[model samples]
Target: MSSSANNAVSSPFQLFDRTEWKRLNGHFSYHLSQDEVDNLHALNEPLNIKEIEDIYFPLAHLINIFIERTKDAHAVVNGFLNKHTQRLPFIIGIAGSVAVGKSTTARVLQKVLSMLPGKPRVDLVTTDGFLYPNKVLNERNILNRKGFPESYDTKLLLNFLSAMKSGVEEIQVPVYSHLEYDILENHMQDVVRPDILIVEGINVLQVNSSKGNIVFVSDYFDYSIYVDADEKDIMDWYVSRFESLRATSFQNPESYFHRYAGMDPQESLAMATNIWNEINRPNLQENILPTRYRADLILEKGSHHFVKQIKVRKI
Candidate 1:
């Protein structure tokens, strides 16, 4: 192909900011201190300077821009309505299929963005909190399939977010138990006016206009990311993560998944795959994965669990 001809066609795997993007050679000149880098490294994962520089730094940089725009918009609205200026949280939505590392992305963002100047109060909340109690799902006969849109109290979720974005001072979120796989009674997590709020879930971006609210929840997200990979790769990841958990977290008798600890490797693989195929995959294909284009950015991962491309939706 001629050099000029090559310019006419583009690779589908281009990251959102492929132009003028510079991948750090070995070490990135981050604001984090050496001690903090040590702590991040101790998270017992394989994240490195390259991933931070390429994937996350650009994201945080863009988020800063969005936050500034939000402040300007709020100022304009206040000026017109003759209302007092209130700080609004910049809402971010992280979405993906099961075991696609959206949780990992959220955790890393929570840590990195918190240290950024003028954004000391970053808070991360999972939509898992809005899930109905196990008893409710059991009664509704959807207990076998818990991650569906019907399993969550969408109305309450909306109220919490609306209050937070409307400049509410303090809001309480219900606490959930991974061990029990249910909402914990008499338990809640209270969040004040955080500078940034990252909400992660399988279907946080799904639309439900038929509900009494009749509002698109994702409209509140100033920016969003959809993690992507082939279906087969995600299944492999789910099984591998389950194996790791069974050998560790699930080993404790008090862990709700401890029952799976007794199963041998083969049996455990079968169980994990069954859960993904029966429950998680259906939810992904139906409600979650279809909304990828709705996201402001997409993190496309290869089979190796590393992001191969970052597609930032054009403005």
Candidate 2:
């Protein structure tokens, strides 16, 4: 290839300012309503239609391109094998530090991507469901390490992914209740085959080894995103989200964190800070942050939890 042609290909980790990224959205239409945006926004996190147009609209367009590319690749492989094969769900993994607004990002992506033409089916599932039951965690004496990768049942998560990718018509996933802060063993969330699957979690990009064997949750992912932000900003968001939850979900009588709801604001703030410093900060530094470079795209957030820059991994 000539030098000019070679230069046309972007190197990995190529960065784009918001304006530059927004230009890519010209090919797609934005069709989200205020009510839809409101339903998707996380408590204490700010996401507006402008943010969607600037960030996610282009992202959905990019993913749509990838989906089409995947179909072409699948057809080629099927032709080479002289057989017909079904197109499985395209898995998109979203990873980020706690309280960095990844859940909101996932919901926004699911909503926007579903609205795109082709009538694609999209489903969002968090890795929280794969967390070990509290009884098991307590038995293992790691209740305090709940969000750590070790707290998850990786084998089960892998099986679920495998089933979903194998075109299984119905797969039952464990249901986790944030209000109760535990896995509802008796309850199951059904994944009726979707065209797109968004798996959002802190450790979605993690490499796991069991019984001297290696497996990565991201191995099944066709596309991946990591939400990035300054650690201090994330800590602030964490404490703020904790406070908001105290006023909301924690107020429920059955909430595991219900005790926090009655605490004085000062006490609650201190406790939230302590949790951030002791649990989440360490997990982010040790595990989550290290995997950011692995994402196909990264949305770096700024003040008030707004995405300020976008990074697209080059082909």
Candidate 3:
């Protein structure tokens, strides 16, 4: 390709620094108390009101714009058809490496979006629930690769998404337990006609090429965000979160990782590092990271876990 042609091939995303991104929250009047922000925070991720005001407030505003426009388009289509049709829920997908604070982002966004005018009902679901049960994973010999794309029941997930878009009044989603590290038997969460649904997970953006799947999980997303950070920083955050869980959740006798609870700090650190290197790191590099550019927006985090830059895909 010629140099001029290469130069003409612009990036799909329009980069915005923190200051510029913060300024995009035009006429946004909703506010979340510090206590609410604190409750939404995930372990090892520092979330404060200022961070919400700067990063997620603007993001919520942008998402509201998309939601409103989608509703308008639906009305227009119905008008053109001279018939009334139910509007499907707006599904937002949040994808990123493990310990990249994507869960916290999803929770915060759900809260912010719920507080928007008319008080829309926003529901959050994680792809972890769509993962094959531990028994199934063990039978398939992929128990150790739980977060990889192959670990999920893609057909079932796709069906669920399809149902949601078809305006199914009530949909039952299986629940996954972190403490048990397995799908809770017979337990389900009912999603009852939410105006908006946020699906968050490490594997949400992944495409199952090996399975030769034509439809992808991300195809259901009306908008998507990928939380991104330096690999070194993510590793450090993962280790830190592991250490925290060792002292808390892992100590529960019912916890799947209860064995790690008794380990000393140094031993816990070493174990966490080994798991990251052997499993999570490879999954991130091979599957998750490659899908980053597929998102409509990317939030890049600094070492302190604060979002330092935002990239919005050009319309």
**Model 3 clashing residue pairs (backbone):** none
After superposition, which runs of candidate 3 have C-alpha atoms over 4 Å from their true positions? 1-9
TM-score of 2: 0.94
Model 2, span 249-274: residue lDDT tens? 99999999988889878988999999
Give the C-alpha lDDT of model 1: 0.79
- Which candidate number maximizes lDDT? 3
Clash counts for the predictions, in order: 1, 0, 0
- Tens-place lDDT per residue, model 3, 112-169, is 8998988999999999999999999999999999998889988989999999998898
Judge candidate 2 at residue 277 and give its lDDT.
89
Ranking by TM-score: 3, 2, 1
lDDT for every model? Answer: 0.79, 0.90, 0.93
Residue range 22-124, candidate 1, lDDT tens digits = 4421332366555554455312235656666677776676677778888888898999999987778888999998788887788778877775656569888
Give Cα distance to truth, residue 112, candidate 3, Å: 0.3
> Could you tell me the lDDT of residue 285 within candidate 1?
90
